[model samples]
Target: MGAPAAAPFPWREVMEFGLGRLGWPPDVFWTASPHEIIAASEAFRTAPAGEAPARGVLDALMRDHPDDSGEAAEA
Candidate 1:
């Protein structure tokens, strides 16, 4: 078999767009980790009506995937 295909969704861009809809500024995105971005996207997907985007999920992701000198996090 060859290498795995890329994800169908453009996760980073999709995440960024979600954050934008949540009233977050662009600078917040530029400085955020992938974990934070993904978490925010997920939170948005599952949030109740009239609720704001959450950072609690982002905290969980950070604990699971820490920064490693520019290395990708392991599954």
Candidate 2:
């Protein structure tokens, strides 16, 4: 008999929680690796107090990958 396939990772919940904790929009989470999420979250925490939200990294990911928006290409 063939071995069972592994369950998919809980990407949605993990991403949502990570982005929420960092105070960044969750839109970038789907494309972010766990390491990236961790790094961004850590940076947010370690940033200077009263500084503007550090969303540049996460926001830039979306800006750079415009085609990954899940929209179908026009014929």
Candidate 3:
């Protein structure tokens, strides 16, 4: 038999994983949507060592456009 298929990452789990690395609380990270998680992850990945975006911008975009697919959000 071939190997079993890998499970997809759950939205909350992925968000928590990304946020945990940044020292955020579970409750805060879990409340974010998948798009938010993706955007946050990308931002962290692209940011310079001391140049992360403001939390307010991340929080606002996440709250205002929770349903965004992350394409428009990135632009």
State the lDDT of candidate 1 residue by residue for 1-75, as single tens digits: 999988696866655575667667777766878788778778868878796546887667766678887576654
Q: What's the lDDT of the predicted structure labeled candidate 2?
A: 0.69
TM-score of each prediction: 0.43, 0.35, 0.43
Tens-digit per-residue lDDT, 1-75, candidate 3: 999999885856675566667566877666777797778878878878776669998778777787767545543
| Candidate number of the best lDDT | 3
For candidate 1, the lDDT comes to 0.71
lDDT of 1 at 36: 82
Q: For residues 1-75, could you state the per-residue lDDT of candidate 2 as single tens digits?
A: 999999998777666667666556656766777798778767767888786545886567656665756764442
Candidate 3 colliding pairs: none
- CA lDDT, every model vs. true structure: 0.71, 0.69, 0.72
Best-to-worst ranking by TM-score: 3, 1, 2
Model 1 TM-score, 2 decimals: 0.43
